[model samples]
Target: MPRSALISALLLASLSLSLNARAETDPWANYDKVLKTLPKDAAATLDRGVSCNHFSGEINGDNSAADKQTFREMKKLKCGTVDQDIASVKNKYKNNKAVVNAIQVYYEN
Candidate 1:
């Protein structure tokens, strides 16, 4: 391969390796970031509400961390997931960017 192509390939490989290592160390890091800066009021509400979720909003924490693929994992987790387009969600978290796609609370009695 040409020198330029070899450099590009190495860079790509290193980046992929770094990402894989990060994920393995903290499988729930993305979720943590999305939930990290929740305002006291909303966080409290979530803890108290019968059903709660952060259905839709952009995440500005770490671009590489929040991704479309994460949605699949979100669903598989022991947490409720909801459609991102719900009006209640939109209105509730209109300006918040740290919101995850969805995370409905399933309180166990």
Candidate 2:
């Protein structure tokens, strides 16, 4: 193979690897990824008394539409679409709910 062709093949392989690693290419994998983000313990409240089926603190409130949109873009890139359905849970009691979905995120000082 020519030197240029070798470089092109390498570049293409690198690109494919990077894309596959960053995005959840599989639908079931995406669902599992989101589910994994759910709080392990019992936490988060549903408005309609609906059980907490979907959950994730990974990109919950720690992200901004403009400031940071990696998570948002990832879903779109992977599934070629986005899921707009979102539920907000407020832990007013500061009880076990707080203990369950405790996020230990840190921001720049």
- Tell me model 1's lDDT, rounded to 2 decimals: 0.47
Candidate of highest lDDT: 1
Task: Write the residue-wise lDDT of candidate 1 on 47-101 in tens digits.
Answer: 3332233322333335345644444444543225333233344357867654323
Angstrom error of the Cα, residue 72, model 1: value is: 30
Alpha carbon lDDT of each predicted model: 0.47, 0.37
Worst 10 residues of 2 by lDDT: 100-109
Cα lDDT, model 1, residue 42: 48
Candidate 2 per-residue lDDT, tens place, 1-109, comes to: 9999999999999999988976754433443343355454212222111212222233456556642464554443332211211112223324534323332111000
- TM-score of every model? 0.28, 0.28
